[model samples]
Target: MATTYRPPRLIIIPGLHDSGPAHWQSWLQSQFRDARRVQQRDFSQPELQRWADRIASTVDHAGPGEWLAVAHSFGTLALARYLDEHADTPIRQALLVAPAEPDKFGLAELLPQQRLRIPCTLIASQNDPWMTPHSAQRWARRWGASYSNLGRVGHINSESGFGPFPLAKRWVEVALARAAREQRPLHASFREWSFAI
Candidate 1:
């Protein structure tokens, strides 16, 4: 049977400094045409409220199919906050990567963020200079997402040397396939004539 596919809406939320050209998020966006970065007020000064608002708006505006949220650094925490605060939306899955330490990073207020029903996965590195493995695991527990502890891969950003993550693509593909399966069937609701299956 021929399959119907809706290219997943990819929301890439970058943390503290916002992803530079060399960051993995930027690389992913260039690789996949549909991916986008959630516009932020300021990454240099890190504003949670602004980031949350932008994320929520982007999520709400999503037209169809599943939402695959990918976050790096503090972006992961921002998506977690959005998920916890809103009960409406079609975010199917999240891939949280390399979350920085809330305390050390001075984002202590966002530490106790709530969890949501969305399925998520956290990929963290053992020797990440910004965060501890144990802390990332804690984030996974609180967010109720599966955890992948990649050993000795510092931060998994371009700084740590990740240009095109083909391995990560496998995981993303599985998530997208699952989303296509669970998504509501698309219909020609406003069309006069539609192609027959």
Candidate 2:
């Protein structure tokens, strides 16, 4: 017999300015009816604590089933902080793309210093101004997340011409398949799974 794979509830978490209509995150939300973006009260200048709180509350309200958190740029830091604080969070997997350097905005001290327990994939660009490719890879290792390097993709945003990133959608599918196979709580080393795009 064959098994059906029901896609997890997607929680779209955009970066500093929030994904505009032309952003890939916005296009992703439109593609999936069940997916929704976590709204932040202030997008102009986000405070770490506030963003973390909002992400936590949104995940909590989504109830129990599987949840796939799609976070980009600074939103990745917010998600990391939430995971660090709440050990038993409901998120099953996460696709963290173009994570902005927390240290750049003086937020390094506020974020978690340890590895995340959830299965996560960190997609980064070689020439992202917010974070260097080396730093992004290091952070992924520190967080126990699988890393993918998209060479010179310029932060992987709308300005980089990523309004409809089909590659990201494919990666999401891969993450979901891995989650289904693992079944148990994720706590494995992800370094061995690193790849390039």
Candidate 3:
């Protein structure tokens, strides 16, 4: 008898204003066969509770199999909050890029202060106005997530010229490969593809 392997579903959680068509997140979604983007009701508003609730709703309807999430900017904050509130989550691993500072939205105390149980990688940039690199590293530590600094890429969004980013694609591929090899929940071990970025 042979066993079947299903790749983790991709959950694309974009930021406050939503990822534009040219944004890397959008490009990442296009590369995956089983991918779903979380749609916020109002992209212009910064309602933390509503945003976090949307994340939960999206996950609830994600069907079957574990999920690998890629969230950017304010979406990272909402994802963190969702993970904090829901201990038993379907999200096996996450790639949180250019996370906006919780303090900027007056939500520092609302999000998880302790380490997150699920494995994640947090990529930061030296010149991202939304969050300082130091703050990004600190939050990575707080969430028990691996951290990477991308030098001076601004916010790692469309404005940063990050359309069709190969690194993001490679990261998801490596994660799915690792999950298949382990035959367990997905874990974040990005050392193999660190040089590819």
Candidate 4:
């Protein structure tokens, strides 16, 4: 079924320093033609609204039934904040990795009980120098997002040594395959996502 809606093009938003050719985001874009980067004026500014506005701009341009946002670090938090305000927007899916901090993104609403009903894969690291697995789990549970800990791989960034994370591609593949079947994740357990891939 692949959702009659095109599940939007994939948009990659980086945090702090942008991902270069060697980073996973860059690699992902290089591998997937439908994938592209979300533009931003500055990554240095601590202001989350500026980044949020850019993300919103991309979302605005994105037609219905055709958007899958892949946000890393601060970008993930920015999207989360935006969702808090624009909860009704039609986004197909989201893949949020290591949200570095909350205060920086102004996502003050996320508590232990809040859930981000969208289908999401919140990847975390057990020994991340920037965050603890507990926080990541708390956030995932709060957002109703499934959490996957990549062992002790740190933040799962370039600094963490992940070069073309194959798991991400597999995740997308599963999402598309499941969508094609028109089966809601609520009735499924992401069991197909268990491939060692």
Candidate 5:
């Protein structure tokens, strides 16, 4: 019998003020049935600790399975904080887009200072006001994530006309393929054992 492949569940972590109906993150959620957003208590004036806790708890409740996290703006910082503090996380891959400058929000101290173990891709715009391209590159290097430049697009958010971003969808598909490839060894071993019987 052929084995069916199951893609990792997607966890959408939106930025401050939350992703509205027009945001790509929200649109992506609508496309994927298993996708869910981490609900933060206060979206207007976000508290770092609270955001981190919410993210951690949501991931924990997702049980033991692969997870792909899509985090935007300040949500990237919160996801990083949760991953840095917890040794074990279900997240296998992360798509961090248009991350805000930690220093600008006085969150440099709260954000993770160390590199993350999870495979991540950081997509940033050249003209985002929240973070310069150079700063975005630096943060991607620090986090040991692959960096992609989105040209002169501003923030790559709803204002940037990314309500239903095709590029973002392609990136998610790529991540899913990569994650499946990485897990192939385990599946191969099981197949070998079954064939030996």
Candidate 6:
């Protein structure tokens, strides 16, 4: 008997204050019925440990399937922490966008210093107030993720006019399609584009 293939499930991790209905994360979730967004009890207070715990809990209860995470801003840091702590995580690939500076929250020492185990893509903007493009690139190197510069998009949020981000949708679709075709764990880079700044 041939075994059936199960596609990777998407786990959406929004940033501080949560992604509003008009935010790209919301739009992404609306597009995928299998996607689940992480819900923090107190979005106002960004306690790293608490946020990481929320991610773990979500993953633990997410049932059986491979996971692909899409995280933004502070949520990106939380997802990194979760990945670092859990070496046996079900997550195969991740797309981190506009990650907030770890030093800003005094979390530089708390996060993993080595490259992450799984494949990842880190997206940064030239004019994001939360993190500089240089800092984003450095972190991407540390995380062993491919870095992509969006150029001058402020934080890549709704206020930055990123409603229904088609690029993000494309990234997810490509990843899913590749995994479905291969019928194995994704060990390849998902970098669609990268530019020197």
Query: Which parts of model 6 are misplaced by more than 4 Å?
Result: 184-197
Question: What does candidate 1 score in Cα RMSD to the true structure?
Answer: 7.7
The sequence of per-residue lDDT tens digits that candidate 4 reaches over residues 66-113 is 566778887777777666667676556788888775744455555224
Model 5 clash pairs are none
- Model 2 per-residue lDDT tens digits across residues 2-59: 5565657788999998999999999888877788789999877768889999998887
TM-score between model 2 and native: 0.86
The digit string of per-residue lDDT tens for model 6 on 59-172 reads: 889888898899999999999999999999998889999999999999999898989878889999999999999999999999988999999999999999999998888888
lDDT tens string, model 5, 1-197? 96676779899999999999999999988877899899998898768788999998888887767788899999999998888887778887788999989988888888776678687789999999999999999998999888889899999889999999877677677777665765686554432100000
Score each candidate by Cα lDDT.
0.74, 0.83, 0.88, 0.71, 0.84, 0.90
Alpha carbon lDDT at 62, candidate 5: 76
- Model 1, 13-117: lDDT tens per residue? 888888889877887777667776787877886667678888988766765655778888888777877777777757767788888777775765764454556
TM-score of every candidate relative to the true structure = 0.82, 0.86, 0.91, 0.82, 0.88, 0.92
- For candidate 4, the TM-score is 0.82
For model 1 the TM-score comes to: 0.82
In the range 37-89, model 3's lDDT, one tens digit per residue, is 99999998988889989988988887767898999999999899888888889
Kindly provide the TM-score of model 6 when superposed on the true structure, using C-alpha atoms: 0.92
Q: Highest lDDT among the candidates is held by which one?
A: 6
List candidate 4 stretches off by more than 4 Å.
1-7, 103-113, 183-197
User: Which ranges in model 2 have alpha carbons more than 4 Å from their true place?
Assistant: 1-7, 179-197
**Model 3 segments more than 4 A misplaced:** 1-3, 184-197
- Give RMSD to native, each candidate: 7.7, 4.2, 3.4, 4.2, 6.3, 3.3
lDDT, residue 42, candidate 4: 73
Candidate whose TM-score is highest: 6
Question: C-alpha displacement of 143 in model 6, angstroms?
Answer: 0.6
